[model samples]
Target: MSQQAADEKLELLQHTMMNWWVQEHFDYPWRDSSEPDWKRLITEVLLQRTNAAAVKRLYVDFFFKYPTAESLASAPVEEVEQAIHSLGLRWRAQYLPGLASNIADGVPDSSDELMKLPGVGPYVTGAFMVLHRNTSSTFVDANVVRLLGRYLGFEWDGETRRKKWLLDHVDALFSHGYTPSEFGYALLDFSREVCGRAPQCQSCEARTQCAYFATLEANNRALAQDNS
Candidate 1:
């Protein structure tokens, strides 16, 4: 597709996806804006390399024990580790304290400042800014990368060079009128449910415009023709 045509299609896809997300939004504890910033950050950290459903199970008890940055900062690292041990992150215990200490004063609004915290990489920093500070920043995690790569028909070899390309396109996609937090969550849910590792393209709202789906359809047609 031409660049102009692709951009227009992406706009339509975003609109369709946003509407679907509003109707079928997943209710996660961390998505609650009423929750404390420290709690959200903690949950995000626990969510890394861990199943979100599993993190949701431990969220309430985990926050009740360490509700604030100061509280988590003061807690013994071993105890912190124990609380999240089920998340399969043995080293997260060590990282949590430093993150808490950095945010003990206040959560930073800027990405640079946020990145200074332990475990506050690009994805976390972008998430924190959008969720906690209501800021516009581009942060691409594995899920976002995969979803966008397929949707946009970009062939990425999983190299650092491709990250910039992914982030740039993601930033453009989010540049539409969608609120950062809502759009972020929509992307998360869509990636998990519709556009997963093995995407459910048949039921996808944007399948008509999805580059990956087009490729799949073409391949299936070619295979059927060969068999005939």
Candidate 2:
């Protein structure tokens, strides 16, 4: 398909995605803007490398005590671990309070600045800025990796090339159609339910234009023809 056609299709897909998710999106407290920034940051942290379901209970309880950065900062290291026991990352959990101190307030703008805090990295920094800032920053999680991987049908595994391609798509999508927060949520929902770990190709709305699906279908046809 031509770039114009693909861009139009992408816009349509983005709209459909928001409609579906607004009705069905998971109701997590972190999603509530009324929730404190500290709470949101904590949720985002616990959410790193952890499933949402698993983080739910822990997030609620953790915020009860260390409600803000100051409280978290003053709280002992062992206390942080004790509260976040179920989170399964004792070491990283301990560092978040210190990280919060460094951030000073909400998520920092520069990735380098965010990284200066404990437990922050390029991936986490990108995620924070995009979801929180609405700055059209590109984000990549495993969901993004798989989403673009299947759709774009990347031939080369060059990490730089791969990252750039995905970032460009994300930037475009955020720029044209979606809010940073909602778009991130939609992408997360799509990746989990539609695209999935093994991928349920049949349920995907975007499958018609999905490079992975298209490539898979083409390959099947070729194989069938060869067998015949």
RMSD values, in order shown: 2.2, 3.6
Q: Looking at model 2, which ten-residue stretch has the lowest summed lDDT?
A: 155-164
Give lDDT for model 1: 0.78
On a 0 to 1 TM-score scale, where does candidate 2 land against the true structure? 0.77
TM-score of each: 0.89, 0.77
What TM-score does candidate 1 get on C-alpha atoms? Answer: 0.89
> lDDT per residue, candidate 2, 194-220, as tens digits?
777788787666778778888889999
lDDT winner among the candidates?
1
How much lDDT does each candidate structure score?
A: 0.78, 0.69
Query: After TM-score superposition, what is the CA distance of residue 122 in candidate 1 from its true location, in Å?
Result: 1.1
In the range 65-160, model 1's lDDT, one tens digit per residue, is 887788888889899989888888678899898888887766776788878888877777877777667667766667777777788887765563
